[model samples]
Target: MKRLSDHTDVQLTELFTLGDIDAFEEIYNRYWLKLYSAAYKRIKERATAQEIVQDFFTSFWINREQVKIQTSLQGYLFTSIKYLVLNYKRAQAVRNSYAEILLMVNNSFDNSTEENYNYKELLERVETEVNQLPPKCRNVFELSRKQYKTNKEIAQLMGISEKTVENHLTKALRYLRVNLNSLLLLTFLFLRR
Candidate 1:
């Protein structure tokens, strides 16, 4: 794994903007394993983590021209992947909670209003973040995260190249990282400083 450096994401984005593919490549090779590890640690699914990294990389390259990262590229990626894993965990928790609630409402006739309400509120907060995504990013994210659609599906649906779909997802996730929670978001955003 390439060692993490103090270099800011803004620098990398500027390099990419100037058509420096090698700079982008260094950023990619440097963080691919680290980011993959972050995702694996959270999701504990090898295939899913690998897919997440692969998707992020593809998206990064696709949007090289327009990609703008404000912090350490590594931190931005880790935070984004963390959000993805949290969203997945949140969805699973809701499903399990709902099942339990149904069983209780059916068997013991007691509704756990507090837990259910809290979970739903958190879920809504996350969903609101997703909804805030730009149109193409939102579409790509929904297709990949919700529909489990492949890049081909997203490309065909959006009538863009698979490469374009990849960029859309990458850029979208970057935006999410900045918006979801401002603590890490702020840390990353100010990474240039």
Candidate 2:
């Protein structure tokens, strides 16, 4: 067998497009470190940088057959890393903005007796509504939401089918929405502060 390391980028790409795993591995091994370092420099976070580079390579391999390399493979990979970093930064900004808003609201609520009372009442009302759900529906909803289980996990734990779990969740949500719309609206308003 020919050594993949001896092949040029264009040849590797062609081989990869033709479903050559060795060529694909050669391409990944050739570029992963450079791409990761470039991403890390831009992001300044090791884990996030690693994830971005890993995701790019995964997508590259997955789309190898359809990918159009308008420039050199090096140029294509670098440009892909650049765009991935930009997108990661943009998403991080949005998440930070939301975190700031939540922190501000939580800090404000810390000293407000009226807000605390309203929050307590809202929690009580939610509990009441949840309790009012039919037995199976309540169990499924609690497992899915409170325990944070996936539908499949809930199904396995409860000895029910995933479809049944989904049905219960849908029914529980509809009941809650109808019964607690006002409470939910009030909670939303409080959080919007």
Which one is best on TM-score? 2
Mind giving the per-residue lDDT tens digits that candidate 1 earns over 6-41?
556666666666877766776777788988889898
User: What local lDDT score does residue 142 receive in model 2, on the 0 to 100 scale?
Assistant: 83
lDDT of 2 by residue, 4-110 (tens): 89889999978988878888899989999999999999999999899888878887888878989889999999999998788667545533553464454456465
Candidate 2 backbone overlaps, count: 0
What are the lDDT figures for the candidates, one per model? 0.67, 0.79
What TM-score fits each model? 0.45, 0.60
The alpha-carbon deviation from the true structure for residue 107 of candidate 2, after best TM-score superposition, in angstroms, is 1.1
RMSD of each: 15.1, 8.7
- Model 1 TM-score on a 0 to 1 scale: 0.45
Q: Whole-model lDDT for model 2 versus the true structure? A: 0.79
